[model samples]
Target: MTGWIESDRWAERARELRDEGWMLMDLCGLDRSGLGRSVVNAGGAGTAGAGFRNAEGTGGLYGPRFEVVVQLLHALKKERMTLHVNAAGDPPTVPSVVEVWPTANFLEREAFDMFGIQFEGHPHLTRILMPDDWEGHPLRKDYGVGKVPVEFISQPLMQIDSPGQSPETVAAERSVDELGQSGPPLRTVEEG
Candidate 1:
């Protein structure tokens, strides 16, 4: 089951769910900046037929730039439900659910670290995955992507430690000249 809740009523709704024997299974943030345009322009292709509207009933498809998704589980009942809350400010801010569910502490912090979603009233909302000095949210759609070179390490074809297998056995089966021709050529950084 899934439901959309207004950002202003997020914390209140979360408390109600908790009192109703629901456990916070997971919480995450999402960037839905341009999704409304894409989905609306795509006509019925991307529409889920569930007709989503903002708090003001403006008929906006996606509502906001950021969203906070909360998954709740009724363990004894073996049921699950998801709540989506749109964060509507510049630096998307949402009320913290840690007061209702202590387990949401780190999860909210992670959302803050990755998507720049601020959890208001959090005890200590700091970056959990990235360095404290990290500039922008890494998972944000508009965040600049940095290009880093990746190095691959070459490994031997056969395991020398395996039973009935040794360096000598491998050498006898395939000579160095044959191995060089069969294996891919190793290239230096300059070559790349």
Candidate 2:
């Protein structure tokens, strides 16, 4: 995609930019099949906040337009760059911008959390705020309301050995036969 866009005849010369480098950085959404249409950021990347979005689905500039991305790439030799995704959808996958800028760690993780975009080369990928058991990326454009189901099961209240006594330990003083027969269920004043 990067190479093709840079070679576009019409788009190459239109935007006045010396191609620094092309980045597969920014991600917009996640497609089950793979990455959907990418969010293309054009020239003036670091200097200014501008992107290339051909809205109306007609291959045209929508908002603040700058240099044709292709033109920018023509001037570069072989240096890393940044691709800034504009609108991320469900499960966005932005390539690691860390190679160019290691500072992208937090931002990329944030993008992963909110947009479900994964950075392929990210060293660590874990939920920052959400619990370990959380399901579904919460910040997607089409967030689903379904949640992970919870299951309840029975287990021993306490182990045989322990230093300090916990509620479970104190409760375990009584035998199972005595629980429903004559003794209190648990946590009764008598047990405490």
Candidate 3:
């Protein structure tokens, strides 16, 4: 089963789960900013997973906005539990669980990198996929899909404009000499 907890009580709930012999399985964040449609549908239970589904069949598995989700496994009991924490903030801040499960370090970093959610009390919260200088969080629904324009420089051997022309014409146009070095211009195809 999945239980929803407030952001302030996140760490405490995690500790409780740990005391119950639940090992942290996974940790991540969710962005529900612009999900134009409701999570529930005629398909029965909507997008809510087994754990997030409310008894009232509401919209989501967690809060209406951002959420930090954790999966726990009970090896001896052969069972799993999902925990949800509502990250309510402009930038969405949640408590760090690294102290509870050291494995959360990398997983939380990845969540922050992709979603721009902040983990309070984290030893180091930084980008894991994008460069440090990257501008925006890529996974956020409101994040723009920025495009980088690329320019290609052509070399004599790699020139693409000589599709129908002979290599000799290409070499001449590029002023490449017999030694494949730039030298005096050679006769053009028409000149020859």
Candidate 4:
């Protein structure tokens, strides 16, 4: 096992890329000063294992500007890094780097789905995961995933699941009995 020091830990890995002109754009994260331990030293830029995977496990801090985002996407695509934009957490929006990095295309959308962060300047931005009618950004910091209220007093769980209908429909079909309770309850699961 090779334990490493902070200052030098990822310096070498980022050296070549940085040398090629990538600014150590905000060594940002919750771990580093203002960024908190949120970002992983900025080296996680455009790969499968990058950015702050919110400690709360609900959201994360993806630091990137429109220009940088586009650039990063382009580089990642050339290198074939699977890209996905994930900003469902609070302040749900990651900069549109697609202008600079063409690869950020679908990745940004995925980020939108997983994190709820909107990508401005994208040719077209729409729901890639949830349906367009999805009430809330499921991955957003403010997303509420609780099951809608129903009548344990009425149909009961066992009765709700009949025929080809999913349990959810049983509740929706009788939303009148479950008024004021359309979307599921929001859980304070993640905080940055």
State TM-scores per candidate: 0.65, 0.35, 0.65, 0.36
What's the true lDDT of residue 25 in model 1? 89
lDDT of 2: 0.42
**Model 2 over residues 1-192: C-alpha lDDT tens digits?**
232222123223222222333433332322222223334434443455345444454254222211112112333454434422322222333345455545556655665665566566678767666776766767553565554344453433544345676766556664555223423345646763
Candidate 4 positional error at 116, Å: 2.7
Give the per-residue lDDT digits (tens) of candidate 4, residues 1-192.
011122222224334444564432221111122444343323333434444555355343243321112122234334322112233334444445455435556665665555555666677667677777766555433445665445444332323436787776666554333434343334567978
Q: What TM-score quantifies how close candidate 4 is to the native fold?
A: 0.36
For 34-120, candidate 3 gives per-residue lDDT tens digits of 644233122221234433233256534345577777778899998877766778887889999999889999999999999888999
Give the Å error, residue 154, model 2: 24
lDDT scores for all predictions? 0.76, 0.42, 0.74, 0.41
For residue 188, what is the lDDT in candidate 2? 46
Candidate 1 local Cα displacement, residue 155, angstroms: 27
lDDT leader: 1
Off by more than 4 A, model 4: 1-91, 141-144, 148-192
